[model samples]
Target: MTNQATTLPESFRELEPYVADWALPTRQERYDMRLSKTIDELGEFYDAIAPRAEEAIGYLNELDLNDLPDDATRLLHLLYSMVLVSYPVNVFKQPRIPDSGAAFFDTVAEPSV
Candidate 1:
């Protein structure tokens, strides 16, 4: 898919009226988070999933989420703001493919269709 950014229409974590029932970080708090400052850490997180994210939009060719659970996919989509971060693609997609087998650790299945 095109390199479009990802976003939720209405977060279950941010539901109004019942918003308090779900614990979510304030928008300012989320923006201020240091872990979100750079693309590297976010990419690192995505890199960890690069290998098995096929079937999902994060698959190398397109933004498919056929691999992870819906909850996990939604969480990652929110954090990275895209289907796949470039970190893994830049660092591990080629020169490190062999050792990068570790990328598949803790792989989770996508929610059933």
Candidate 2:
């Protein structure tokens, strides 16, 4: 496949620093380390990219959900995941840890096609 980075939307540019590698994993892989970021790091990342989130979502909303290209599909999924996770859902509450222990953890699974 061509470098997916070249095809990403401008709204997604801010996320490049954190998610440059957007690799889709194989069935054998349960999680992708590339998506890992500490809570504070994620907060910073969100702060940087939050401005574009709406535009990204608007672009996604304009797409024909039934017939999106692989890249567009991936972007839509990534954007959707970001919106969902950003909401303060008590059901998905994270555990508290010491500042020293605040480091990126590998847990995000690759988006399923």
In terms of TM-score, which candidate is strongest?
2
> What is the TM-score of candidate 1?
0.26
Q: Write the per-residue lDDT of candidate 2 for residues 25-113, one digit (tens) a residue.
A: 33222123213544454455446556777777788778887787765665655554454335322222332232526474554564445
TM-scores for all candidates: the values are 0.26, 0.50
Q: For candidate 2, which ten residues in a row score worst on lDDT?
A: 25-34
Give the poorly placed runs of model 1, Cα more than 4 Å off. 1-35, 38-40, 58-84, 87-113
- The alpha-carbon lDDT assigned to residue 93 of candidate 1 equals 45
Local accuracy of candidate 1 as per-residue lDDT tens digits, 1-113:
12333232222232122112111233333223322335555454444444433533333233355665445444444443323334334654422234655463332443332
Q: Rate the local accuracy (lDDT) of all candidates.
A: 0.36, 0.49
